[model samples]
Target chain A: MSTTNNHEPILSFKDVTFAYEPHVPATLKDVSFELPKDSFTVIVGPSGSGKSTILRLVTGLDKAQKGSVQNTARTRMIFQGGALLPWETTLNNVKVGFTGRKMSEAQKTHDAMAALTELGIDTLGDSYPRHLSGGQRQRVGIARALVSSPELLLLDEPFSALDIETSKRLSDEVLRIHSEQHITMLMVSHSVEDAVMLADRILVFKDGHIAEEIPVSLPRPRTITDPEVQAIIKHVQGTIPSSG
Target chain B: MKVTHTELQAKPRMTTHYWSHRGRRAHRTNLLHRIGSGLVLPIALVLVTGFLATGVALVPSRISAEAGTLLAALGASFLRLFIAYVFSLVIGVALGLLAERGRRLESALLPIFDVLESMPVLAFFPVVIILFLKANLLEGAAVFIIFFSMVWNIAFSVVGGVRQTPEDVKAVGVVFGMTWKERLFKILLPSVFPAILTGSILAVADGWNIVIVAEALRAYAPQSDKAHDLFGIGSILVHASSTGDSTTLLAAMGILVVAIALVNIALWQPLLAYAERFKFE
Candidate 1:
C-alpha cells in the first residue's frame, strides 16, 4: 500500500494480468503502465491485440486476475458507436450522466446544455440519437461524458464508425477540447496515424503486452505530412506483427 | 464533372424558388389529406356501432328488454374483467422479476408456469369453485378463474423481455452507477415495456374469451338461484341461448362484439402506439 502523494501517477497498472476464462490464455499479461496527470495518451494496436481489454481494466469495467490496478481519477468512458440511449434525446442522454449527483433537474439540464454548447452541438439538444448523424452522435457522446466533469476521459474507438473526413475533423475537435479542459484523456485506437496526431504519449500493444512506448513531443496541430510525425507513425506501425 | 458558372448559379435560385412556392401549398394539402384519411376508421366504427345498436333495439318484444339488459351485463362483465386483469398484471410481473433474478429460479419456475399455462383454466374451475364456496367468495372465485387464464402469458412475456434486454443497455446502467431500484424502474422496466404491452394485448383477449365461462359458472353454484348467479353478459347470453330465444341471444352477442370493438379502438390501440416509443433500436 502506497500513500497518496502529488508525485503518484493518476492511473497505474502494476503487472496486471487478465483472462476471460481461467483455463484460457490471458488477454492481458503482466501489463504495467502509468498515466501522469493531465496527459493525452493513446493505446494503439491491431485487432485482437487486447487494446480494449486494457481500457476495460482502466475503466474498472473488468478486473485484473493478477496484480493491481490503481486509478485515482474519476473516469468517464465514451464507448464505440456512441452508446447514447436511443429512448432519450441528446440533452436527456447527457443529463443521464449526472444521475447519481445531488442536483436539481434544472441544474442537470443546464449542465447538459453547457456541455453540448462546449461541443458546438447545443442546438441538437432536442434531437434523439437516431436522428443525428454519426459525427453528431459522437459529439453527444462526448457531451455526455463531459457533463460529469470527470478527471479522466476514456474513449473506446469513439470515431471508428465515422468517415475519414469526419474522423479527422472530430479528432481536431477532441484535441481542442482536451487543450481547453486540461482533462486527462486515454484513447484506444487501431489507427497509428490517429495516435501520432493526437497523443502526447502512445502505448503500442502486441500479444497482450506493451511492445513499445513512444513520446510525441511535436508541436500542436500535427499532420501526417510532417517528417518527424511520419517517422513515429512508421515506428509504431512496425512494432505490431502482421496477422498473415 | 464540369459545370458552367452561370448554370451552377442559376440552378440554386431556380430550385429554391420552385420548391419554396410548391412546398407550402403541398404541405397544406398533405396535412388536410392526412387528417381526412385518419378520420375514416373512427367514422366507420361509429357507423357500425350505431347500426348494431339499432338492430338490437328493433328485435321482437319477447327480447325487447334484452338489449338494455345485455348492455348492463356487459358493463358488469367489464368491471370483473378489469379487476382480474389488474390483479394478473401485478402478480405476473412480480413473478417474472423473481424468475429473472437468477438462472436457478428461472429454470425452476418457468417450467411450472409453462405447464400451468398449457392446462385449460376450465380444468381447475371445480377446484376454484369448491375453494371459493368454502370461503364464501363467489366473485373472488370468478375473477381468480379469469386471472389464471390471463396471468401466464404476461409472466412469460416479461421473462422473455427481461432476457432480451441488450448487453450494452445493461452496461450503461452499470457504468452510470444506477442503484438496483433505479435500474429496475428506469432501465429494466422501460426496456421491457413493449413486451409487457404485447402480453397485455394477449391477456386482454384471453380475459374476454374466458369471461363468458367464468361469469356463467352460476349453474354450478351451491344454491342455484338468481341471487347466487353472477349477473353479467355471460350469464344473460347463456340464459338466452338455453331458452332458445334467438332474438335475445343475437342482441346480446351483437352487444358483446360492439363492446369489444370499442375497447380495442379506445384503449388498446392508443396504448400500443404509446408503448412504441419505449422500444430500443
Candidate 2:
C-alpha cells in the first residue's frame, strides 16, 4: 500500500442541498463531507440515498441548490455502464478526454494509447464499445478518465454490472492504479463489501445525510474473508435501512 | 502480466488478419458487382425508351414526337423535385433542431407540424399558387407544394432521434468538457445521422408521390396550353392520356419509374449503407 498524507482536502461539500423537481423534497439535504487528497473514499448507501448525487455534484455534472461544493483538483467521472461512446473506438473514446487541450493529433493518440496500455487494453484500441465485453468497456472508461490525469477520479457504481470475480479483478486494478498514481479517488456504491475491500475511508449515507464515516486502516491486499474487513462490511450493512 | 513489444506487435497482426478475412468476403460482392447489378434495370428501361423514341417496331411518327416531348418534360419535373427536396431537407432539419431544443418549443411546434402534414397538400395549392403568382414565381409555387408534402416526415424523424439519444452518451459529453457547439456537431448530429437518413428516404418517396399532382395543377391554370403549360412528365402524361395518346402516356410512366429506380439504386442505397456507421447498435 502507498502512503498518503491526509493533511489536505482535495474536495469538500459544505451543507449542499439539491432537488430534481421543484415540488419534491431535496434529494440531498445539508450533505457535508471532505475528501482527503490521495485517498480512496467510497460513499455507500441504499438506493436513492443521494450517494450518486454527491458524486455528480463533485464532478460538476449537477449543481447544488444551496450551499457550496468546493474542490481544488481537476476531476473526471466514471459513470455506470462505462458510458463509452458506441461510435468511437477504444482509443478514440479515451482520446476524447484530450479535447480542448493544446496537443497535436499524434500526441493525443500516443497519450490515449498509453492510457489504454496501462489499463491492459492497448490491443483493443481499435475495437468499438459494442464489440467489447462489459469489463473491457469499463476499463476503457477508466482509461478515458485517467488519460487526462485528473487529480480527483469519481466513479458511480462502475462495477455493478460485472460478475463478482470480474468486479474483484477490476477493484484490484483500481487499487493498484490509485496507489501508483496517488490520485484522490471517490466512488459511490451500494455494495458494502466493495466499500470495505477498496476504500481507505467509507462514508455511509442514509436519507440524504452522511450517517457515518468509517476509515479502514487495515493493511493492503485485504481479503473478503479477513475478520476485520468482514466486520466493517457487516457493520456498514447493518447501518443501511432494510427495504420493506 | 506486463505486455511486451512482441505481444503488441502480434496483436495488430491479429487485427489485420481479422480485417483481411472480412475484406476477402466483401471482395466477393465488391463495388463493381454492386454497380453492375444496380444498373441492369435502369439500362433496360433506357433501351426501351430509346426504341420508342426512335419510332422503332411499329411506333408511329406522332407517337415518337410525343415521346421526345415527354422525355424533356420528365427532365423538367425531375429538376423541380430535386430543388423542392433539397429545400425541404434544410427546413426540416432546422425545424427538428428547434423542436428538440426544449419541451416548450416541441409542444408549440410539433402539433402544428402534425396538422399541416396530415392535411391534403392539394388543399394548399390554391394558397401556394396565389402567393407565388403574386411574386411571379410559378415554378416556386409547384416546388413549395412538393416541399410541404415531404418536410414533415424528416422533422418528426429528427425529433425521434433527439429524444432517443442515449443518456450515457450525453453524460459522456458533459464529463468530457465538450462545449455546446462541439456536443451538437460532433455527438448529437452524428448520433442522429441514421435517423436523418431514414427520414430523407421517406421524404424522397413522398416527394415522388406528390410531384405528379403538383405538376398536373398546371393543366387547370389560366391561359394554359401545350406551348405555355408547365413542361413536366406529370403535365405531359395528363395531356397525352386526355388526348388518347397511349404511347406517349406509357413512355412518360416508364421514364418516371426508371428515374426513381435509378435514384434509389445509385444514391439512396449507398447513402443508407454509409449511414449504418452512425447507428448506435
Candidate 3:
C-alpha cells in the first residue's frame, strides 16, 4: 500500500499454466500476476491449489508449461524446511547458495559471517546444522538467502514447520526486513492470520486460478484486533472457495 | 488450579539440560570406543605390515607349506581384496549416480541390479572366466568377482540416499543456482555419505567371501597351477585343505579372522559413528 504509482512490475507471470506431470491436470490454469516493487504479497490457498507451484515457478525451479515468466529482479527463496546442509556448519551453509560464482573465499566468509551476525546467529557459525534447533536452522536459511542481497525474496511456507512463538518472531523479522531493506516479498501461506499479518495483498486461490485479490490498506504494525484488519480478514475467509 | 504456559514449557526446558548430560555420557562412551579401536588397529596394522614385509623379502616361489608362509599369503590375499574393494567402490558410486539420471533409467536399473546382485558368485564363473581371464588382469579374476558382490550394496544404497533427499533441499539447489559440482560435493555426497559407509561395510564382507575363488581360479583359466594361482590367504587355505597341510590352514584361517574383526572394529564402526552426523533428520 505504501508503493508509489510504479507501473513497471519487478516480476511477472503472464498466462502461466503448469503441471508437475504430463498426464496430470494443470495445477495452475492461465494464472497471471505482476508484483510491484517493495511490496509484500501472500498467496493463500488449500493444498494443491497452485500456491506453492507459483512460488516454485517464480524461482525458476519449476518452469511454466505455457507462459512468460519475466523476472528482472535478482531473487532468492527461503524453504519450508530451512533445507540446510547437514554436513556444513552455519557459516558454510550460508556460502552454499553462492556456488560457482567468482568470489574469493575470504570475501565470501566475511559476507556469510555478516549475514549470520545480522540474523543473531554469528556466534553459532561453527556449529553444524544437525546441532541447531529448528528456529536456528530457519534463521540460517534466511541468512543464506539474504547473503546475495537479492532484490526479491520468495518464501515457500517458511514458517509452516515452526512452533507458534518461533513463527511469530520470524514473521516480525520478515516484516522488519521488508520495510528496512525495501525488498519485494512474495509468500505462500495457508494460515489466514499469517496472510493478514504480513501481506499487503492476499491472492486467494480456488481450484487452479486466483479467485480474489484482497488488498490491505492498513498502516504499519497492524494487529488482529484492529477493526479494519478484522474486516479484511473476514472478507478473505469468505472469499476462499470451500474444498470438497 | 491452572498452570501457566511458561510453567508447562519449563518442564521440557529442564529435560533439555538432562539430555545434555546424557550427551556428555555418550561423548565419554565414544571416546572410550575410539581408544579401544585405536589400540586394535595399530596392532592389526603392524601384523599386516609385517606380513607385507615378509612377502616383499621372499620371492614368489618361497610361498609354501610352511606356517611361515601363512602371514605372507594373508598379506597377498588382503591386498587382492583391498584392490578389488577400491575398484568396486568407484564403480558402485558411478553406477548409483548414473541411475539417478532419469526416472526411467532408475526403474530399469533397479531390477537389473537386483538380478545381478542376487545371482550366486559361482553361477557367474563362466562369464567371469571369459571376461577377466581373457583380459589378463591377474588372479585378478577374484578382484572382479569381489567387485560385483560389493558394488551392488553401494550402488543401491546411494540411489536410495539420492531418492530420500528432502524436496526443500533440492529446491534450494535450484533457487541458489548450484552447479553440478557443488551439488555433488556439497549436497549429494555429504547427504549420501551415511549410505555409502553402510554400503562399504557390506561390500568388504562380500569381497572377503569372493576373494577365495578369485585367487584360486587360475587352474580353471587353463594356466599352470604354480604360474596362475596367486599366493593369497584364500589360495593358501585352498591349497592347505587339498594337500592336508593342517598347520598352514589353521594359521591362514586365523589371520583371515583377525583381519576381518580388526577392520570392523577399527574402520567401519568408527566411520558409521562419524556418518551419523551426515544423515538428514
Interface RMSD of each: 10.0, 4.6, 8.5
Clash counts per candidate, in order, are: 0, 0, 1
Candidate number with the higher TM-score (1 or 2): 2
Per-residue lDDT value at B149 in model 1: 92
TM-score of 3: 0.85
Deviation in Å, model 3, residue B18 alpha carbon: 22
Candidate 2, residues B205-245, lDDT tens digits: the string is: 88878777677765545555565356688877777778876
For A157-238, candidate 2 gives per-residue lDDT tens digits of: 9899998878988999989989999889999997899889999899989888999989999988788999999898888888
Cα-based lDDT at residue B244, candidate 2: 72
The C-alpha stretches of model 2 lying farther than 4 A from their native spots are A1-8, B1-72, B219-229
TM-score of each: 0.79, 0.83, 0.85
Q: Which parts of model 3 have CA positions greater than 4 angstroms off? A: A1-6, A242-244, B1-68, B222-227
Model 2, residue A194: distance off in Å is 1.8
By summed lDDT, the worst window of 10 consecutive residues in model 2 chain B runs over B15-24
Clashing pairs in 3: B142-B214
Candidate 1 lDDT for residue B57: 40
- Tens digit per residue, CA lDDT, model 1, B1-281: 11111222332222111111111111222423433443445545544664564454444676565567777889999999999999989998888888998778988998999899999888788788889989998899899999999998789889988887766566666677778888788788887776787787789889988888778766666556655668898887787777776566666766676777566545654555555456565
